[model samples]
Target: MRLMRIGEPGHERPVLASPEGRHHDLSSVTADIDGAFLAALADDPGLVPEPERLPETDIAGHRIGPPVARPSALLCIGQNYAAHAAESGAAPPEQPILFYKSPNTIVGPYDDVLIPRGSKKTDWEVELAVVIGRRASYLDSPADAAAHIAGYAVSNDVSERAFQLEESGGQWSKGKSCATFNPLGPVLVTADEAGDPQGMRLRSYVNGEPRQDSGTADMIFGVAHLVHHLSQYLVLEPGDIINTGTPQGVALSGRFPYLGDGDVMELEISGLGGQRSVCRPA
Candidate 1:
């Protein structure tokens, strides 16, 4: 089922879209889409109520907030796509290139992405975001890692190239954590509904023009391996988010120019919903 949260920020209510297009309330089921609730939903499939009648909501009309309001951590991988790695003039890493983005950077779906003040190389990365469902540590294998996932969502890993590559002494996080950088969700699709995460077609468009377009097959490290690899270093807790890297075709790739104010970004993974945001001056 396509699960969503509605209402105002700091007051979102859980909801589900029924097969008949009715809005069945899951608010009666849970408070937020965090780790604990995810684990519970995983165990008790019946907890989510089927809405007899879809309720009217203004998700886009209301102030849409970040899908996961309070994620425990927001981890990201870099250069996980060989083409994207090559585009950025880097080699595929011997291991996953892991980094963290401050949770404060989280923003609502379709919100305007701010190009940081004094920035010139603002870039966009359309990526698949993994939301953790249960606590996991010392994963024995990639297959075991797959079971820990709660759902998937679309995300834009917005970057300030200058801060990410030059000003901050080469630390990618420096350019990655700008406020409103991680725009996530139109909806968080549960794992059962998001089949075969590895083969989906993912794309990014700026101002209605396509920029990055590729398949998840292009990923150097697939989801299971990434989860297994990451669990070796840190425990994967519920509500933690890991943004798998973007495919090639970013402005940094030179196929397209960098994003400027008023440029719009739209991204999608085949089964997951699409997300769109406009660029604006910081």
Candidate 2:
């Protein structure tokens, strides 16, 4: 099932998009699509209620907010794609390289992406975003990781190279945590319906020109491994999102130009849908 939140910014209401492309109101079943709601649904699927029984909501004139609410943590795997690692001039790591972007960086998929002031090397990354459904502290094996995943969504892991590399003091969050840096969702496809996370074709474009174009199969550390590995070091709270890293063809490779005001960013993942964001001055 595809879950969505519709309305303006903070006023978004939960919605379930039917196979026929209809939006059914989910507010009566729950208040919002936040961590608590996701955890409850994970424990009791019936808590979502039946969309056929709920009122049909018209989302045409409204904005579609991020499928999941602001999460407790926004974790990311860096250079998980071998080609991307090569482009960044690094050897494929023996283990998953992890980092954190402030959770508040999340914005509606269609929202305006701010080009942080004094930023000149802003870039975009198209990644498969994994959403957690349960608290995972330490999983017994990578196979156990599937049970903890709530779903998947498309995420644009926006970055500023200058802040991330040059002025980071060896830490990346300062550049990664800029407001509106993470443009997430158009919809969140449940894990059951999302199929295998490692096969989806994810791509990105800037101002209508192709940029990143690769599939999740290129990821050095797949979703299950990343989750299992991370659980040993940090708790994966319900509603937490893990950006599985982007493939080759980002501006960071010096093959394309950095984003600028008035630029349009289009990102998509197979089955999960797409996001189109407009860039503007912060």
Model 1 Cα lDDT, one tens digit per residue, 81-168: 9989998999988889999998888887878899899988999998999998878799999989777888888988999888988887
- What is the alpha-carbon RMSD of candidate 2 to the true structure? 0.8
RMSD of each: 1.7, 0.8
Per-residue lDDT for 111-145 in model 2, tens only?
A: 99999999999999999999999899989999999
For candidate 1, the per-residue lDDT at 274 reads 86
Clashes of each: 3, 0
- Regions more than 4 Å wrong, model 2: none
| CA shift of 252, model 2, Å | 0.8
TM-score of 2: 0.99
Q: lDDT (0-100) at residue 176 of candidate 2?
A: 98
Give TM-scores for every candidate, taking all chains together and pairing residue i with residue i.
Answer: 0.94, 0.99
- Which candidate's TM-score is highest? 2
Check candidate 1 and list the clashing pairs. 22-54, 23-54, 24-51
What is the overall TM-score of model 1 with all chains considered together? 0.94
- What's the lDDT for candidate 1? 0.84
